[model samples]
Structure formats: C-alpha cells, structure tokens
Target chain A: MSPQQPDANPSEKLSRYEPEVREAYARYRETGDVDAVQIVIIAMVREHLPKPSDAPITDEQKLVEDLGYDSLAVAEVVFAIEDTFGLRIETSEIMQISTVGSLKEFIAKKLGPKNE
Target chain B: MSEARVMPTDKKGRRRVVISGAGFITPIGNDWAGVASSLREGRHGFERVEFFGNPNVPVKVAGTVKDFVVESMNWRDWKWPARYEIARETLRGLAPHGVYAICAIDQAAEHAGLARGALANDDATGLYCASAGSAMMLHGHLGQMDRTRGERGNPMGVVSSISGTLNFNLAAHYKITGSVCGFVSACASGSHALGYACDDIRLGRLNRAVVVAGEELNAETLLPFAAMRALSPQSDPNVASRPFDTARDGFVGAGGAVALILEDAETAAARGARALAEIAGWGQAADGHSVAMSHPEGRGLANAMKRALSDAGADAGEIDYINAHGTSTPVGDRAEALAIKTVFDTNKKQPRISSTKALTGHPLSLAGAMETAFCVLAMNEGFIPGNPHLVNTDPVCEGLDLPRETLNERPRLVLNNSSGFGGSNVCHVLRAVG
Candidate 1:
C-alpha cells in the first residue's frame, strides 16, 4: 500500500499500543512499509497527549479539545512526525489540520503517493 | 558632583512607604537568621559545577541555591507557605525564574500576614518584578523552532521565556488588578522595581505592591558570561568572588530570587503589619557610556547616590552604612569605589561599606533586590556586613572604610547602590523604623 492510501475508515478509533496500531508500527519498523505511516502517526499523537485516557482517540477527535494539544504541543507532534519520516512540515500546513483524521490525511499528502 | 543638596519638599500630608515583608532564596540561606549567620561568619556559597557537559568550559564556580527543590512546584519541604501548592496549569506558563518569583512572593505574602487571595481583583495592589526570564527554556524552545524551521514549538515559549514572563505569569497567579509591570535596567532592575513601587505607594497610586527580582542558573544563562570573560576563573569558591581586592578578576555568577512587600505606612499600621524598614527615597541615573561597562569614574553612580540622598532630604553624613555594588570585576569594582569616594568623600563622610556579593555572587539583574533585602536584614539585626575576602583593597578605595568583619552596630540609615549594564545606576535610601 502507498503512504498516501488512507485506512479503510480514516475516522476509526485508535489508542496507544492497540493491537493493530502496534502491529503496523512493527511492520513499519521491520519493512519500512509506507502503509503503516498512519498507525505510526497515531502512536506518536497518543504519546504526546498531556493526559492519558482509556477512551480511544478517533480521527474525529479534536486535537485541542479531545487530545489536549495546545499550539506548542501540536508543533511537538508535527516535529516528531518530521523527525520520524524525514519530512518537512510547514506552519501553514499545520494550520490546515484540526482533528486527528485531518492530521493523518495531512501527513498522507505530505508523504505523497507510494514509489511505483 | 553637585555640592548643593536638593532639599525634599514638605511631607506633612504625603503618603509614606514602608517595607512590611521581604523574602529571598539566595546562596546563603532562605531566611534572615540563616543568611545573617552566613554573612557574619564570612561563609561564601560558591560551588564548582560541571559546565554544560563541556570539558573546555573556562568557568566552573557558581553560587547555586541551597535547600530548594529544582523543577518541582512543591516547596513544602522548604517550609514555605502552604499557599505554594501551585496548580500544574499555572506552572505550565512559568519559567524557572517565574517559579522562584512565586515562591519568594509566597513567603513575602505570608510574612506580611496577607490573607489568601486578598489582592484578588484589588486595583489598589500592584505587581512589579525584575526578571530576564529563563534562558534555558528560551534556548530549548528556540532551538526546536530553529531545527524545524519554525514549524514546531512550545505554545508557552514566548510568554514563559522572555523578560516579561514575570509580569505575565505573576500577575495572573496573584490576580493582580493594578499596574502589572516588569523593570528592565539589567542589574539595576531590582532597585528600579523597589524604587518605583515605593513611588506608587508614596504618591498614592497604589496602597500596596509586591516587588520581586529573580534569575535562573543554567548553562544558557551563565556560560554567556564565560564567553564575555566576565566570570571569575578562580577555582576556589572562597576566593573566587573577591569583590574589592586588587587581585579580583571577575564576578562569580549566581542565581536566585528576592521579594519585598511595600505598603502605605498608614495602611501597614492599620493592618498591624510590622515595618522592616522605611524606604526613605530612591534615585536613578544613566551613564550614557559603554553598553557593558561602568563610567571610568563612576559618575553616573555618584549622581544616583546624590539624588537618592537629596530625595530623602538627608546628608551623606547621615548614612551609617553602604552596600556597594562591588561585583569583584577589575574595572567595575574600581569604578564603583571611585563613585563611592566621589559621593561620600566629597561630602567628607566616611560611611562603612561592604559588598555582600563576596558571599552570594552576582545574581545579574536581581542583585539590587537581593542586596537591598540584605540591607533590611542588617538594619533590623543591628549589624553591618563585612567586605569579606578583601585582602588587598584597590588603590582607588583609599579613603573608603571597607570593614573586614561584620560590625555589631545598628545603623539608622543605610544606602544600597546598584549599577547595571549600559551604565544604568539606581540607589535607594532606607531608614530603620520601629
């Protein structure tokens, strides 16, 4: 699968180290699979959340209201993504993202279509 | 220097300002008793620290704070007021200096017996602080932005890491409704805060004010001085910060916070608050000279001292002791000694003098606040601090009476002088009050 390919349900619920997310991260680590980028992004977001919660984070969850990501925290997560994927995210690009799903989609666009 | 003294106007109906409470977190100690003991015994607070994990760093000695928690809001073990259980949300907006500020203010408020939240929404109360923010935090935040090309950073970075961080976080924490401001004249910032706070009270602009000055200890803050060759290279902590000795090289950098509560004398009396000292008068002047060096003859400092004396309607002879801004630098100490002689000797008065910086090191912008607070302690404790480690005084200090030991004498009038980078000078005159 290409890095730009969205999950079956882009708004699907996610949590830290959940089975499928962890599985994707392991696959990404082992094979450099671009398809696991979304899961990797979700895991990074969960790690940056100020407060831990049992409620699974969804793509629809607002970064500010639901995940408690202030502007700085948002910057932190974006920087983390850039570090992880060797990508450069712009400030304007960050502003276009509001919810978890939007962030994943934004990263998907930044990563571009898979290498043919 | 002017030979004619400017007499103060009639003060029959003028409001009077008094120092009701003061607190500090210095290298010596947190409380007056402990600090006094250290000063009297000539005990210095310098310690060698690993500088920025760099083996080639030239300076290693610093006067670090003792008996205080680092990177934590909990000061319960430090015996601070119970009101210091600061919420984590508020802590998020504060830098290390801001934290020290609030902690010092907590002690001040409790010492004044101010009811919890008494200043909430009170427009008559003011908050004034002298701070240059947290260099460590600023460096980290800016580094993140630099590495990411400004795409990512901490939301609280600007407010928590700049010079005005104190005014922002402190005013919000205390709910100050009056003038919330930060003074920025470098080392003279602390004295400027106190002097202006006194003005507000004396002029009836404010009935009460909390004044603070704080600095942070970190490689980002201290190492820059090493680059400037402004830090002492002496490895022995005891002799590193010799303020007036001819052999003195440079100041030993230090960090901490000091706070004082100024109140209308009548209001303090009504509230049954004890006055530590009466802030008689204050004066400020500029050198218009170098950006980082004092005037060769300390002319600006002399003018400041003269103005302060004139503002108080007192003669130079009336001053029993002087707390000199002697930071042990080669040029700076000589300049200050010359300034002292120009003011007092011209008036033919030989007041006892000493620089407590020999004990606490130079706390940068907060030096004035910390040293003035020391003056208050000396006045109340009936002793004058010695110029410790002054083995060989410079020739410019020829006529000055720099005591070699703490004097067991009570001073009726005390003067504290501070000079900052850019040659900004501020002086305060305090009178012992019952």
Candidate 2:
C-alpha cells in the first residue's frame, strides 16, 4: 500500500485480494512455473465470487456464464491484476482469453525472461 | 410608426407552466416550509464557515448549509471518509455539487409526491439546472495532475470539476430522456435555467423538468469573489449581509442549491398534482453596457422586468411584490433600485419590495432559484418576506416600498430579479395559483 493513502490505516492489509494476487506473482516469479500458482489464481478469481460456488471454481467455470462478471467488471479485475503485479496486459490478450488456468499461464509467460 | 411585432413559436400549444414542488438547502432552512417560516420571521442564515479555515482567506462569513458533509461512497456500508477511497477507486470522478443537486431534487420529487411510482414510466421527465462551478473537486484534481506532471493523476476528476457534469449526472440518475441542460449566466444562472425550463414546458417540448440551482462553497470559488472585492467586509455573520440598507457593503459568498419542479399546468391538472404557483412569464437580457458591472441606469434590468411583465400580460401596477436583486453592494442595490423605480414607480400602487438575500446571503447562482421559491412561499403562506436588516434604506432606494416588516399580503404577481457579471439580467414572473 502507498504510504500516503489518506484514508486507509497504515497497519491494515490492503485486502485478502492483495495477498492472493501477490502470492500468484511470486509463485511464477520464483519457480519459473505456471502450475504452482493455480491455487493463487483461483483465490484471486474468488474475490467477488458468489457463495454456493465454494465447492469448486475450476478453470472451466466460465468468467461470465458462471461468475457473472460483465465486461466492465472484467476490465476492472484485469486492471487491478495488472496494477498489483506491475505488468501491462493488452486488450488482445484480454479479449482472446477464456478459462482461468489459461490466464494464469499467459501472465506467467509474459512475466518470463524479465524474472530469473 | 412602430408596428406591433409578434414573435414566432406562438403556434405551438403554449402550455401554462406552474411550480408543483420546491426544495432548498440554505443557511436558514433545508426544506421549503422551514426556510419559508424562517424568512417570514426575518431570520438570518449567515454563519462562520466551518470547512475552510485558511486565515489569509478573505470573506469571513457564509450562508453555508448546516450539516451537508461530503460523504465517502461505499456502495455497501455507505460510511463516509472511509468510502471516499472506494469512491475514488470506483468512479473516474465525483462531484459535491452533483450530490447537492441530487439531494435537492430528491426533496422536490418527494414533496411533489412523484418520487416512487410517479416518474417510473415518464420518458419526458427531463431537467435543467445551473452549476456555477464544482471548483473544489476541479482544483484538487488539477493540483494532483500538476504534481504528477499529468502522468499519474486521475484525469477523470476533470468531469467533476467543470460546471457541466451536474446536468449529465442528474439526467442519468433520474432516468430523464427529454432534455438536460446546465446554464451558466453568472449569478443569474439559476433564473436563466428556470426561465428556459419554463419556456420548454410552455412550448410543448417537455412535460416536466427539474430545475436545480446548485453551488457549493469552497476555497476555489470564494477566493476569486473575495479578490474581486465582492464579499462584505463585516466579519460578523449576523449583520454582514445588509441588502438595500444604506450601510451595506457587498454580498456574502454563500453556498446552497434550490430545486423546483416546472410542469405543464394541463398535465399537472390531469395528474391532480397541487400547483404551488404559476410561472407566468420569464425575461432575460444582457446589459452590454458593462462587463463586470450592471448598467448604472439599470436599462437592462428594467428591460428584463418590462419584457417579463409584458410576457405575462400583467400591468406594472398588478405586481403585488418585487423580489429585488439587491445584492447589498452599493452599485448593485442602487442600479436595481433605479430599475424598479423606472418600471413600477408610475403605478398608482407600486409593489412591495424586499431582498431575501438579507436572510440567505448571496448564494451566487443559487440566489435566483431560492428567491423565486421564497416568492412561491410568500404567495401561498400569505406572508411577505421582510428586509430583516433594513435599519436604513439608501437614499437612492427611496420612492419604493421596501417592506421593513413581514406583510400579510397574498401576492398575485411576483417578479424575482437575478443579475450576474458580464452584464446578464434575468427576471422570472411567478403568479399565485390555487
């Protein structure tokens, strides 16, 4: 969190979403592997996920058909992910994207060569 | 010989427009009944501003709304200051004036018994309002942009900063589809908006419109007026705004929004809605004679009043009350006095005159709407708002009946005056209706 955040308490964590997003970045960042970050990726997708779906949030869960995120909410989630991980995600990547595991692998590949 | 000239657009079904509801937030009162009762008793709304405490800032007093705090936007919890972060995170921009405008419109909608099911299917329910400027939000946004050299700051905040966003926000919120406009005519902005809304309804274009005169007091807006020597010198809020009095200095830069519902009389009748007052006539003119000052002879001011009276087809003598644009400045009060003299002096019964600014302070663009609302209150409640601070009228203000005490006269015709810088003058003629 920025030190100068006017409203938020300094000691408080940004959100449960923050640690989930950061852990995913570190997983692929350290191991040079995408499979290890699958749990982290699932946690990130569940931030606004409705209850009743707690049994499973598989890669095939479907972004809109199952999660109910409209285009705008999807853009916001993508932006938050990009800002948290400090990577520029392109609209082409966003539009062609489907399935959660594919997104996690795509981010890992984009972050490759820059890390170890 | 000059032949009688008829204006076009007369063929359109000229619907009669009337005020069905009014809502206001002011120093004296937040609702019409409370504000109107305060006005009848000749109470002042001026108070020391609480928000801005910069000592070097001029203009010590303001008619600030008592308890309207800018809340933080947390959609779920709705808690303030904390939700502020959530608000900034969610929307590209936000506006305090927009909030005030919505609050006033809510009051008006609820008052007219049209909030819930009334406007559900109405497509023609549009609105027009005046926004002086959302200075605080704009200035803060600009400062951040400058600090980051335009690279990081939220450029979206610019929408909240300008004077036009209120129109869009209001229309979208109310689901209005007819037309949404924000008029900027300096201090006369409110009157111009009201007058134009009345025109649209009268011209058979819109069925109902909410006209909001919204302004929020902030350092960005106040410093400019203070620099112009427009604010009164009297530090004490109690006696600072002495409109039309001999000892008057200048206006107090205050803040508030007043919203009124203008509806076609036939539609209002069909709906069985109570009509507060009939918007009989509207007149607007620019005093090209001066830019920052009104014509000393009040030619433009007189012209607007004469045109309004003519438009209403009411003789000068028929005017029972005059809500003067007496802004407490020496020049403004004198110019308005001369204009009133020229317009109504010849009548065997000159209208009773008083400046409600004595109570609410000069609410900038909000002045016209609030004063016009006060006129409706005066007509309905059968009480003339008195000049509470009128200890001595200026010599130039003589020959007019400045009501020192609140009179019990039910006015048939009320002319409300509002003038602005760059030579703008607007008069709205409100007539009593059962």
Candidate 3:
C-alpha cells in the first residue's frame, strides 16, 4: 500500500457547504488547480500583511508571528479573502489557520474531490 | 446697543485662560516665521492639482499643504528631526486628518516644554477637537459595503470615518484622563472648540486643554463643495481666492491642521510657560437663517462679535485688528462686510480688517483654529496679515478698512469671527501678553 499523505487524511475540517459556500469553489472544482487558488490567496495575504517587508512571504511563514498580524489585521485579511474568493470563512475556522500554507491547503481542499 | 452689555463673571469668579503653545500644518507655512514671511511677501498657497484623476470636477485650485508626507503609515515630514512611524494597528483607526492632528498636538506639547507622554493619565489636561471626518476613508468604507452587498466591511470604518474620529484617536493616543469632546458646527467647529475649552478652564473644570482642528483635502472632502456651487472656479493660483473683493466668485478649498494649548493663566505661569496670548473671552450666536446661506445682514455674526467684545470687557474700538471670516464667497463676504459695518463701522473705528483666507484658502473646520492661531502669531510677531487680494473691493466692503499689504505692527487686542453652515457663528477675543 502507498504511504498516506498528511492532507490525504481529513477527519475534522470545514464541510464543502457549512454555512454558505463560495462561487469560486465551483470554478476551482472545474479545473481542480490548487496552484491557481494558492497564487490568488498569497497575493491577498501580502496585501493585508501589517508589516511590509522586502523579504518574500513564504507559504511556511506563520500568519500571526511571522506576518505580525494581530487580531485586527487578521480580520482584515479574512475579510479580504472572503470578498476576493466569495467565501464566508467562519470565526472558528480562523483559529485553526496558523500558517500561510495551511490556509491555502484548507481552502484548496474545500474545492477538491469528495472521495480521495 | 439695545441692552447694556454686562460681565457675567462677577457672580462666579472666573479664572483666566491663555494660549501657551501653538503648532500648525498650513498651506501658507508650517511655523510662524514661514507664515510671516509668506504674508509679508504676499504669497498665496494655492496650487492646481488633479483631484482623483477626474477632469470633470469644476474646481481645480486648492491651498494644498506643503512638505507633508506619509509612507507605509509613517509620518515622515513637516518638521526636521521629528519622524513618527505609527504602528499599523493604531494607524488602522486613524484617518488622514487624525494623522495631522496627532502631529500638531505633539508639536504643540513639545513647543510648550511639556515632556513627551506627560499628558498620559493627567486628568487636569483635557482635549477638544473639531473635524468633519475622513472623507476618503468614509468613501472607501461605504464603497466596500456597497460592493459586497453588506457582506464585509472594515472593522474600524465607523470610528475612523465618523465626525469624532479625532477625539477618539487623540484621547486614546495621549491617554487623556480629563474630558474628551468633539465639536461639530461646520466651519465654526474649531471656534466652538476653543470657546468651550476656554470656558472649561475658566470654570476650573480643567487646568489645561489641547484644542485641535484638522481637515482632509481630497476630492472626496473638497469636491462636494463644488456640487453646492460654493467653490471658486478660478484656475489661477494667484487670484483664485480674493476675499472681500468685487471680482470674487466663491471660496477656494484648503486643508491642514492647527493645535494650541489653552491653559489657566496662573497655572501656565506656575509652570514657567510663556503665554503667547490670552483668551480674553469668546461668544456664540445662531443666524436662525438658511442652512447654506448666511443672514444677508450677518445679524448673527454681528451679535457674536458684540458678545465676544462684551465678554472680554472691551469695546469695538479696543480691538486693534479684526480677522474677518471672509471666505471670498460673493454672498458670504458681503454678509461679513455688513456685519463689520454694523459693529466696528458703527463705532467709527475700523481696525485693520483682513482675511488671511486670501492667502490660505478656506480650510473649512480648520478655519477657526488656524485663523485664531494666526491671530496669536500676529500678536507675538508684530504684524497684521493683509487681505492681499482685495484689489477691486466689493461695493459693500467699501467702508471696511481692508489692508492690502501686511502691516509691521503688533495688535494688542484681536477679534476673530467665524461662521459656519446652519448659521452657527462664533467669535473670540485674544489679547497680546508680555
């Protein structure tokens, strides 16, 4: 049997339609390109980063510590994501998002297949 | 002349209030020296700048503030060796005017020899400010809600864009323990703030007060005046604003911030602070007239000036100079002319009348504080700022002694008159101090 990937196992996460689903998810499903979703998400993240830097923002950078995003900046970034991607990310969902990579993966999974 | 003017202070003894420190960010200049030079040279601060890249806006000329720059939420200029990089978190709640307000207050406090952070937790020091809000932030906030169909909005939108934005930000940043208030009466808001601050000090409610007035100069805040047909369409920077002039069409828009420290005279003396000018007295009256138009006779303005003189225990003849609230608007200037005629003209003593608005365009909410601060500067610097552009005087202003050139003479007693939309009028009497 093939080795199981970390993201391959999904036990507790946001359902495809928990509150209201995003229209962008439907477009993502049509192409199933996570890279495209990550690119757009990263751009939005950069725009809302509280402390701008010349260094490149990596997917592994922690949102709160590395980006210097306090609660207010986090909310701004979340609002920007919801507006840009047509997603209604819940307050409970934000606590679980620690790193930029995790956020992108979680958002990408919402647009991925139902059965692995 | 109808009823004898009586001093109201005899009943409850009043404390004296004086202006100890002043700071400003004006289009004419940042400091007294710079502004005095501009006044003496008859220089105007008007500039033709594109607003929002829109070519259809009728008004183009404005008294744009100079040497002020903010990058990455950092205040970089306006004074040498004074740079402040506001954290983005705090900056989130501040509008453009709030930025200028903070800087002006800092400069004022520093000029007064008050140590940095000295006002924190100081209950005896209060704060009063006048601002209409940040139009650019308001526009952005409202546009976001509209675009999202109310799905998303800026968290700080309400506080950052509302009328009391300055009071909120300033009080918090300074950690003010005393009364924190905002005055809103259109262009007269600043005057109202100063008047009330003086009252607070005189009543012993507070030992000192920091009064600030600021405005945002952007297409959002300024272009709206164009819709009312209240803005001058003159494109030339040289003659765009001609207060009390027959050729004047409308007022030109300007923006900046001014702040002054109004403290108890005895308290200022004890603290070894030099007094710039004493806030002799102040008054206010309503026109009971149109919302957008002043009384044709300037009845409320005349009453305000009279009350201010009475409050100061002085007569019209006692005033050495009069800083007219002449915005150069055809109707407004004429009304003011009539008001001056009713007051000083009736007394047969025309103090060298002038509207520095001829040099610095109408700064709206910042007008009262700016003009009053100019009065303080004139008192200290020994010069009367000229109207400069009053060449072809309006017929109604013929009786008024509008000086066309700056006079190198100190004014002992100065009266400042300010009127706003909704017929709000406020006047203050300032006296030079040793």
Per DockQ, the best of the predicted structures is 3
DockQ sort, best first: 3, 1, 2
lDDT of 3 at B419: 99
DockQ of each: 0.19, 0.13, 0.35
Q: Write the per-residue lDDT of candidate 3 for residues B239-289, one digit (tens) a residue.
A: 989998889989999988999999887777777777888889899899999
Q: Which scores higher on TM-score, 2 or 3? A: 3
Candidate 2 Cα outliers beyond 4 Å, as residue runs: A1-116, B1-13, B50-52, B71-93, B153-155
Q: Quick one: best TM-score, which candidate? A: 3
Q: Kindly indicate the candidate among 1 and 3 with the higher TM-score.
A: 3
In model 3, the runs with Cα more than 4 Å from the true position are A1-71, A81-86, A91-116, B1-12, B69-82, B345-347
Q: Provide C-alpha RMSD values for all models, in order.
A: 7.0, 6.9, 8.5
Docking class of 2: incorrect
Model 2, B1-434: lDDT tens digits are: 11211222222336788788888777788888789778889888887763355665667788877656753221222222221122222332346656666667778877776755355347777688888767777777677668646533333454566888677666655667788888888899999999999888877788998999888777777768777888886788768988888899899877878899888876777666788888888897778987788899888899999988878878889899999989899889999999888888644788899999888888787888888988998898998888888888898877789888899888878999999998899998888875
Residue A13, candidate 3: Cα error in Å is 27
Clash numbers, per candidate: 1, 0, 0
